[model samples]
Target: MAAVVHRLAGPALLAHRDGIRAVYAAAFAEPPWHAEPAEADGYLTRLAGDVQRPGFAGAVALDGERVLGFATAWTSSTPLPGTRSYPRVTAALGAERAAAWLCGGTEVDELAVSPAAHGRGLGRTLLEAVTRDAPDARCWLLTSVRADATVRFYERLGWRQVTHPAPDGYGTAVFLGPGHPARAAAVLPSL
Candidate 1:
């Protein structure tokens, strides 16, 4: 069956809160330091409210009404704006730095496609949906060091690693948006 991707408004997200959380929990059985923490049932309900705010966006890839993959993003009001910050944003990015980094751009708060749906480009498709919808916004995300495959996947899509596993920050790697300044030397044609 063909996958149908739908952009979910805030209220709609609340309506499918459980499904959204499922994606996060499954994807982040052990996500990176900077990446948000896995969601609990309660967190799922909280997210429904958060994603409804201005500058927020989310999408779900469905195959005949079943969620196969999902993505969500949000706008920031600080210096280094991002979509949404989760897990422990302050600890992951350094308290002061976290707020600075998430001030304006559209952040890929969460992106997950089940293993069963891998290789079908759902991750990329969901990403494209947010980016396309927010042409004026910069995009970014935090991913784990262990997620080697996922890292390579983002790189192929024009994202650049801003943070590394080092003393100053969580072992997490921060990926900048498409064509971001840091990505100047890392551009590869999108597939």
Candidate 2:
């Protein structure tokens, strides 16, 4: 079955919370964000909050009744929120440093697609939904350096690597904006 991509608007945002949680859980299972399953609900709630925010938005691709993929973002005067990690995620891009990127731009809070739903253009669709509306958005996002495929994917979509080494002892990519010129430089693969 083909996945139907839609904007979760109005109160429908909250209705799809569980499905978003399921998608996130499956996507973040790899390094630097091996989150405990219990935290899934909290993450979804935060995403819900972003959906309701005036300038924030999100999109999801549903394969039948299940959420196959999703992307969530917000325009803020602040940088991305810092993640609480055991032993501290990394010294390079700590919470405070990570938050700094939020200045003067919109942040890609989270973008993930379930393994089963890979190869479709859903991720780009979700990104476009957030960016198309905010033409002034200074595109920026933070992702683990070790997540090679994710890094390559974002690079292909025009996000850049602004951070030196990832905060979690891994490197991270800090995108400048969608379709930014810096993205043309050779992508720095994870060491």
Candidate 3:
């Protein structure tokens, strides 16, 4: 499919809003995610606001005018957000580690590729495009451990899993970028 991935500051992604939403709806409908189709609409709504956040960045993969995949990210807040998976992430990594590893660093919030577009490397391409400008490559993202393939994909890309969900805890794990400063010294559990 000769898809081209374009990294952008936000507006460009918004321009492909409907296409991006379709990709999200399709990609997350499978496996452990099983996100509702309506969730894609909500995501786009929240994304409109997310672009206003500090260090906001985005990327979209397009095969002609059709969106094959997309990725979004921004600087992690200093005080640490208390929403979505933030609380769980803090619980997993602890306040000190979370603040140091995530705060002010690029936080990869979403990476999605349509089911029909799988195996084309669009996910990795979008991920790299979005995080390309991460300061010192200090990037991080959280995903469900239940999604084995997703976890493996990040690991295969050299991202270091820096947190292991506590045995009676949530199923999320945080991963640091391959070249992130803390990744090298991270003594966290192995995948």
Report the C-alpha displacement of residue 102, candidate 1, in angstroms. Answer: 5.3
Separately for all candidates shown, the number of backbone clashes (residues 3 or more apart, or on different chains) is: 15, 7, 0
Q: Tell me which of candidates 1 and 3 scores higher on lDDT.
A: 3
lDDT of each: 0.67, 0.67, 0.88
Candidate 3 global TM-score: 0.94
Write model 1 residue lDDT over 25-114, tens digit each, in one string: 666655442325444465676675777666888788889867788888877555443323343454555656555444566777678887
Model 3, 34-101: lDDT tens digits are: 88999999999999999999999999999999999999999999978788788877877778888888
Better of 1 and 2 by TM-score: 2
TM-score of each: 0.75, 0.75, 0.94
Candidate 1: clashing residue pairs, number = 15
TM-score sort, best first: 3, 2, 1
Q: Which candidate is the best by lDDT?
A: 3
Candidate 1 residues lying further than 4 Å off, grouped into runs, are 30-38, 79-102, 135-137, 165-169, 185-191
Rank by lDDT, highest first. Answer: 3, 1, 2
